[model samples]
Target chain A: MAFFILVIAALLVSVFFNSLGAVSLYRFPDVYTRLHGATKCTTFGTIFIAVAVVLYAVGRLLESGENRFWVLIIHTLVAMMVLLVTNATGAHAIARASHRSGLAPAKAVVDRLEESCSRGGASQ
Target chain B: MFIFFASFLMYLLLVWSGSGIPMIEVVIGLLMATVVTFAYKTWHPEKRLSKRGLDPRRWFGFVAYLFGPFALGLAKANIDVAKRVITGKIRPGIVKVTPALKSDVARTLLADSITLTPGTLTVDIDDAGAFYIHWLYVEDENPSEEQLYGNFAHWARRLAE
Candidate 1:
């Protein structure tokens, strides 16, 4: 009963955050802020989903004493790690490319990147 | 050496069944690990992964950070972003943070950590170690490492440096 409750709660959290991620794309002003919303929220949401799946796998492993469920847990973890790394790196790439192509943030109070670009760009 | 052993162990662990493992699987695992190690070395010739990560203490620290501060910050970030998404109150801007990290591994770790947690998206890292971040709520033009990413800089230094 407790295991099912935990799994349900995890799924609920995952759905809420994922829906928020979709909403954020329309809510934010520019690509950067939109990236902030879409990337972080989805990444976090997927993490919860992975957790729930892992929990399910664990329960199966314990109930049946199956070695296959162990593999299921491992595969889930590997998928989660790949998603986490790729999500963050992809966000960075999009943000950098947008900034490089002269797409500035909207309604900004400060842009040190633009400031640095104006001042002959920052060098090592 | 580190890559080879780590990959070998991982491959064996995945291939392991409840019964005794077969010799063929062990041979295949060795071959795969060797190929991966050589490919990694050729791709990043300049980066000789330091022995620092090999220290067991660092691994323990990293695991603790993952479940402790990293997890907490991720929760906070999602809640904060969710609230802002609903209310439509965002003070967005690109600001700079200079975290004086020496190694590339540490810098990348910090950048990824910053991006995943909080209202910060790592836009770019300059030729120097300064990070240009798109903050949802820009409170400071010149924010410190703590302001931008809490103890992530310290954790990066501990785990990767």
Candidate 2:
């Protein structure tokens, strides 16, 4: 029963965050802001899903008094780690490409990149 | 180094408490993870730190944004997609939704998020971080790229605000 509750909570949390990421994609004033919200929320949501699985496996392990819990927990954790690294790196690449492609912040008062590029041109 | 050790120790304690793992095993596990992290850092020393310095306050704001208005927007999108799917109202076209994000990290996040969702698939990303989206249902009205991205950008800023 407790395991069921945990699983349900995990699902709900994951869905909630996924929804949040989608909404933020719309609300964010600029691409960078959208990226920040989507990446962090999705990462956290996926982590919760893994945690739920771990909880279920651990419960089973305790009930059976077996060593299978280690397998589930460790493997799930490794998977989570892979997700963390890949998602983050992917986000970085997208942001870099976006910046290079000339998308400006909708409400920027300062233009540091513009200044630097102009400075480089003048130097040449 | 101190911060990393402290975090590892905290993780060790948590795992040991929850999993009923032996302290020695927990320590070993934590050590292994730390070693892996160190190896990754060594392999990519130049990319270790973010060009924009980390700020905790901004991070918290970003989290709050995700948990609030962003969620609302996703809910709406979900409903919209469901409606389109059920009604068979999808035109299904690939359209470019260019975002104005300055960071590669941010653009990747946006793209992945779009891909993960049901109705939209990210087909291609250009060098400038512009995403080509294949919508399951494109309305006959043919929404402009700016119009399409406008919804996403609004919620994204709120989520990361």
Candidate 3:
């Protein structure tokens, strides 16, 4: 009963964060802010979902003592790790590319990147 | 070589059945690992493979860092973003920081860590090894490495460099 409750709670958190990611897309004024919201929220939301899956797999393993449950648990862990790495890296690439393509962050307070770019030839 | 043993072990780990693994499966895993290592060596030729990752100390440090500071930062980051999402108050900007990270691996690890840490996102890493980060709330125009990324710089240097 406790395990079920924990799984449901994890799923609920996942759903909440995922919806926030979607809402931020429409709410944010610029690409960088939108990327921040979408990338971090979705990655965190997916982590909770993965946690719920791992918990379910663990419950099955303890109840049935089956070998396949071990595989499920391990694979879910591996998948979560892959998602974490890929999502962060992808966000970095997008930020770098957009900046290089001359997309300054909208409504930014201070733009040090612009200052550095204009100071001297900091080109590659 | 380190790659051979690592791949072989990984293959066995994936195929583990809790029940004792059969000898033929182990044999096949070895054969697959050999083919992979052969292909890898054939392409690289110069055996300049760094064996730093083979160290058990580094692996333990990395695991501890993952579950310790990194996990805490991840939770804090999500909550912070959530608060901003609800309130819609932000002071975003791209600020620069120059950490004395000599190795490419350390730079990469730091950039990725900063991205997932808090209100900071790594936008560009210049050829001169300085990082331009997109901070949701830029506290200072010229921020220190610690201010931008906390102790992640130390962890990155220790773990990767």
Candidate 4:
């Protein structure tokens, strides 16, 4: 009963975040805002899903005393770690590339990078 | 040596069965681990497998980071971004953050953490190790390091430096 409840909760959390992400992707004005919403929501949603899998594996292991479930838990954990690390790195790369390609923030008030670049050029 | 032993143990774990131990599998796993370890050493000769690399304190700090500030930041960022998305209220801009961490590994870790958390995306690292981050909501034209990263830099320094 507890396992089912936990699984249901996890499913709801993931679904909520994922739908919000998709909605934001459609609603946001620019590339940067869209990226922010899409990347973060999906990543957060995936974390919940990973948690659910880990919990299910643990519950199975405890119920049956099976070593295979233990392996499943460990592997799921490794996959979660990889997902977290790679998602951040990949987002950074995309943001950098977008900025370099001259996609400015839509409603930005401050442009520190521009100021810094001019100052750096003057000093050199 | 430590890398070889660790990889050998990992290989054994990967091949472990609930039934009986297999000597043949153990021998093959050991040989494979040794070969992989040697290849790694050849590719990165400067990276020696030292005791410091396996320090329990560092591992503890890393685990603490994953559970503590990182987890909190993820949740907070998600909520904040969700609010921004719903309300269309964002003041996005690029800002410079110069953390005191000197090591390359620590700096990279800090950059990755900042990019992962709360309305921040690490855009570039200059020659002087200053990070240029694209913030989703920029409150100030020139924000302090504390304003940008809270205690993330401190945690990165502890864990990686």
The parts of candidate 2 lying over 4 Å away from their true place are A1-124, B1-14, B19-26, B51-53, B116-118, B140-146, B149-151, B154-161
Model 2 chain B — which ten-residue stretch has the worst lDDT?
Answer: B84-93
What tens-digit string does per-residue lDDT give for candidate 2 at B33-107?
A: 688678767887776445233567666766665556445545445555535423434344445555766665566
Q: Evaluate model 1: give its TM-score.
A: 0.94
Using Cα atoms, each model's DockQ against the true complex is 0.74, 0.05, 0.68, 0.53
lDDT agreement with native, every candidate? 0.89, 0.59, 0.89, 0.81
Fnat by candidate, in order: 0.85, 0.00, 0.70, 0.56
Which pairs of residues have clashing backbones in candidate 3?
none
- By TM-score, is 2 or 4 better? 4
**Which segments of model 1 are wrong by more than 4 Å?**
B17-20
Stronger candidate by TM-score (1 vs 4): 1
Q: For residues B41-88, what per-residue lDDT tens digits would candidate 3 score against the true structure? A: 999899676778778899899999989999899889999999999999
- The positional error of residue B42 in candidate 2, measured at the CA in angstroms, is 4.1
Report, to 2 decimal places, the DockQ of model 3: 0.68
For model 3, how big is the CA root-mean-square deviation? 2.2
Clashes of 2: 37
Which residues of candidate 4, in runs, are more than 4 Å off?
A118-124, B1-6, B15-28, B31-35, B47-51
**lDDT, candidate 1, B7-106, per-residue tens:** 9998987787656689999999999999999999999888877776788898898889889998899899999999999999999998988888988889
Q: How much is the lDDT of residue B6 in candidate 1? A: 93
Residue B20 of model 1, lDDT score: 66
Please give the distance, in angstroms, between residue A95's alpha carbon in candidate 3 and its true position after superposition: 0.8
**For the second chain of model 3, what is the TM-score against the true structure's chain B?**
0.88
